[model samples]
Target: MTQSRPPLNAPHSTAQSAPGALPGTPLRSPADVLGTGVAFPIGVNPRGQLSMVSGERAVTQAILSLLMTARGQRVMRPEYGCRIHELVFAPGDATTLGLASYYVDEALRAWEPRIEVEQVQAQLDGQDTSRIVVDIRYRLKGNPEPRSLVFPFYRSL
Candidate 1:
């Protein structure tokens, strides 16, 4: 008989460590160490089970959730959201852009710890006078590759 190796993403459940790796260290899936969570705009799987997001996708979804949600939207978690929505009524000027960038930076730093924020910029959209384009550049704490996200913040004026 032979014991086949589990897939890289498969979770192991053994009291003892993996052979030849480390005496006391337990085997862990790389995906688990990265992260995992319920998918945004969540949907059911083919078998009717809830879908999930993992690794980089999970981090992206978390950041999106933090950005799109307004403070006090959650029933009991009032402080779990960003304040950029408040700028919807403010004038779309340099000061407003600065404030928007500030709000995004603050929210990401406060809510998500898996990634380190690199740069945050708020610029005017070329065709939309009432829109402020927020550009966020960040990377996972241990990874050197960078990722970026663009969020358009619109003002009533």
Candidate 2:
């Protein structure tokens, strides 16, 4: 039996989606899309096995990991992290907060594929002037509900 391949000039079939699908979306299993991973901070579970996170929690942990890693800290992947560390020493003012917001938005947009960022707003912590709270509002693709994560960045860190 002979198998046939589409002509080289043919339009990609990947452009098409499953019926009742939305544009720019691909049908994927929850496990494949949301992902599973070892829990961040590397702790063991009650079973004495490494902790794991999946679905939304896994995605959230991935985002936090990306935000926490400083660019260039990873020797091989020099560009693997958020540039928000650049503002670690900057004055905790509106300008600094704005820049932080921009960094968070830019980094997530570049590195993460699971969620669409809606807003990234940084504000000074009410009790601690040196703490800038980065609020990230985002939604997983194919999922409509909005979710948020509050990451507190301390200048002292």
Candidate 2 lDDT (Cα, 0 to 1): 0.89
Which stretches of model 1 miss by more than 4 angstroms? 1-30
- In candidate 1, what are the lDDT values of residues 30-134, reduced to their tens digit? 467678888999899898989998988899999999999998899999998999999988887899999999999999999999889999999989999888899
Every candidate's CA RMSD: 6.5, 6.3
> In model 2, what is the error at residue 113, expressed in angstroms?
0.6
List the candidates' TM-scores in order: 0.81, 0.79
How many clashes would you count in candidate 1? 0
Q: Name model 2 segments beyond 4 Å from true.
A: 1-29
lDDT of each: 0.88, 0.89
